[model samples]
Target: MATADTMLQTALREPARRLTLDLRAVTFFDSAAIHAVVRVAERFPGTLAVLPSRQVRRVLEISGLASQDWFDPS
Candidate 1:
């Protein structure tokens, strides 16, 4: 969670219009991590794209976050 927040903070400091998070290697993540990602996406709006792992996908689905507009699977 802390690590994800730190990474997101650093990434947001950059001047990119879009942020693509390739979370395919992340096999495990808790709600805190999900919260961090969702916060970032909320801050950036349509600029967030998430390529989530199967586990992450399940978590998002279970958390009802997968239906969010910012949860781009592609």
Candidate 2:
């Protein structure tokens, strides 16, 4: 989770209109990971696109974060 947070922070430092996070390879995540994702989404709004794995998707759904426009299941 610390590594993920560091990576996300490093990525967000750059300027981009859209940031697509391919999380299909991520099989597990905790609240800290979810918090980081939400922070990015809040900071960038529609600019964050998430390709979540089944587990990640479930976390988002349970947390109600899946309803956000930035969470793209496709």
Candidate 3:
């Protein structure tokens, strides 16, 4: 997940408007991963779209980061 985070950090440098999280390949994710994503979102004024599978979505929903606030509609 840290590797994904690093790539995300770098991706944020571009002119993209949203961050799509493909959590299909992710076998597991911890609080640290959630925190890292939140921190990264804070770095940007826009939003972050966490496009996790049903399984991963459950984790994010339980972790309290499962709102549109994290998803960029713009």
Candidate 4:
């Protein structure tokens, strides 16, 4: 499970844009992780493409962060 701190740290260095996450590598994501993603979206410019697992999507949905465009095929 990658910690939010670690994830945020990586995001900081990477150019802001679309972020495709392979949730299979992420075994856990607590509120802190969710908060970090929100923060990144707010601070960065452009969409954060989250390729989360079904479990991760569940978490995002329950957290009110999931939207129709989140996984849109288009």
Give candidate 2 misplaced runs (Cα > 4 Å): none
Which has the greatest lDDT?
A: 2
Deviation in Å, model 4, residue 1 alpha carbon: 7.9
> 1-74 in candidate 1: lDDT tens per residue?
65787867876787788888888888788977887887788778988888888898899999999997767666
At residue 33, candidate 1 shows an lDDT of: 86
Q: Residues 9-54, candidate 2: write the lDDT tens digits.
A: 8667978888888889998888888888878887788788999999
Determine which window of 10 residues in candidate 2 has minimal summed lDDT: 2-11
Where is model 4 more than 4 Å wrong at Cα? Answer: 68-74
**Count of backbone clashes for each model?**
0, 0, 1, 0
lDDT per residue as tens, model 3, 1-74:
65756755675676766666566666777776676667767765565666566666667778766774764222
Ranking by TM-score: 2, 1, 4, 3
For candidate 4, write residues 24-65 as lDDT tens digits.
555567888887777666656456566776667778888877
- Any runs in candidate 3 off by more than 4 Å, and if so which? 1-15, 71-74
Q: Which has the higher lDDT value, candidate number 3 or candidate number 4?
A: 4
lDDT of 4 at 71: 37
| Predictions in order: lDDT | 0.82, 0.85, 0.64, 0.67
Q: What are the TM-scores, per candidate, against the unseen true structure?
A: 0.86, 0.89, 0.62, 0.72
Error in Å for residue 43 of model 1: 1.5
Q: How accurate is candidate 4 locally (lDDT)?
A: 0.67
Candidate 3, overall lDDT? 0.64
lDDT of 3 at 69: 71
Q: Model 1, residue 32: what's the lDDT?
A: 79
